[model samples]
Target: AAAGWPLSELFDRQFASWLDLDPALDATNRVPSILNGGLGKISPVYWGACLGAAAAIDLYGLRKKRSDPDYFPGKLGFDPLGLYPSTTTGKRRMELAEIKNGRLAMIAITGFAFQEFVQQYAVVDQTPLLFKPVSDVVETYGSIGGYGM
Candidate 1:
């Protein structure tokens, strides 16, 4: 969910603007590299907040545990539907699902890397379904040969 949220946000016009990405201007065979430009300027604020959030969560967990000796620190018992089973088989299923989700997220990140390496454009621009048809995109930006490769 974490990786997917950022990926989706990159395609969102307003969110991408907030992240200092201008789809219209960024549509070119420009290599992705270390932080620079407007993104570089705002990156510290975004990452700093993420670090602060993590610290806050840790402090809250510690305070809760200290206040209640029997308190479970990690799990919040968040299953509203009570679907989480206590059985061993159910636990294994949950674990497998988590593993699959993580692997899928990794694959998605890898795909983004390769797409940038070849397409050399914003993911939103490279995606045909976003701004144009597949045929149009392939014509305008050839598959695997988009950046004169």
Candidate 2:
């Protein structure tokens, strides 16, 4: 309403994109209701909390892992920092390494948050959306980082 950019079109495009993304659920047949089609509406709040936690970790500390080679999964060949020190040296290299590590960690955190939301909210009762039934496993059986059931 205030700006030149059309917010309506932005939402419409997102709606169309999601509808198209899931071939099983098309825009023609599917629409929001009391229970369903509200997936994108409600989950972002919770997901943002999860990502925020990751951001906080990066901002605060636990950066000891940045310099520690044993911290990263070298055995798995996953060098998150990519801090070879050949291209960059001294403080800049370390800064870049930390930034890189932080990004990778954030990605992992976001993905975990997405899955956690899906497991907690997406699948209902006992049935899972797919295999390896994670339905309420965390809330019912286990807890993450002392987040008990």
Candidate 3:
């Protein structure tokens, strides 16, 4: 929940605007205030509420997971969709797949953050292939000149 607002804003074409928010990019100490500033533009009370919700979820999940020995983190009490397999091997495979996918997503997000930091450009604008079927963008913008090649 804490990441939802920033992720939404970034995906909604506010990626460039983030440069205006933290140009130097060294103000790690003021993350809360920065988050509040951006969130305040949409809703004055969103920041605190989101923080509270994140804290509550963290606390509740930790407590609940600790209390239940057999309760898997992703398992629903009742799988109405029957997506989960009954076999232990199938369950372990699903867990491993979930972890791997989560790790892949985290890596992608980290790469996006680094790209934004160094390039100071929106990933969508840089990644033309995502929005259209164009090869010229990669040809024109993929040069290594900016890295002093």
Cα RMSD for candidates in order: 5.5, 17.6, 7.6
- For each candidate in turn, the TM-score is 0.54, 0.24, 0.55
lDDT of 3 by residue, 19-137 (tens): 45433222221122232232233344655798999888777767778888887676435578878878999989988998888887777766656654555444444545554345655
Show the lowest summed lDDT stretch of 10 residues, model 2: 1-10
lDDT of 2 by residue, 64-147 (tens): 356555544222334479644544356466556677887877665455335434444221122222223455555544545322
In model 1, the Cα lDDT at residue 86 comes to 85
Off by over 4 Å in 1: 2-11, 16-41, 58-74, 129-149
After best superposition, candidate 1 residue 91: deviation in angstroms? 1.5
Better of 1 and 2 by TM-score: 1
Error of 2 at 33 (Å): 23
Q: What is the lDDT of residue 77 in candidate 3?
A: 56
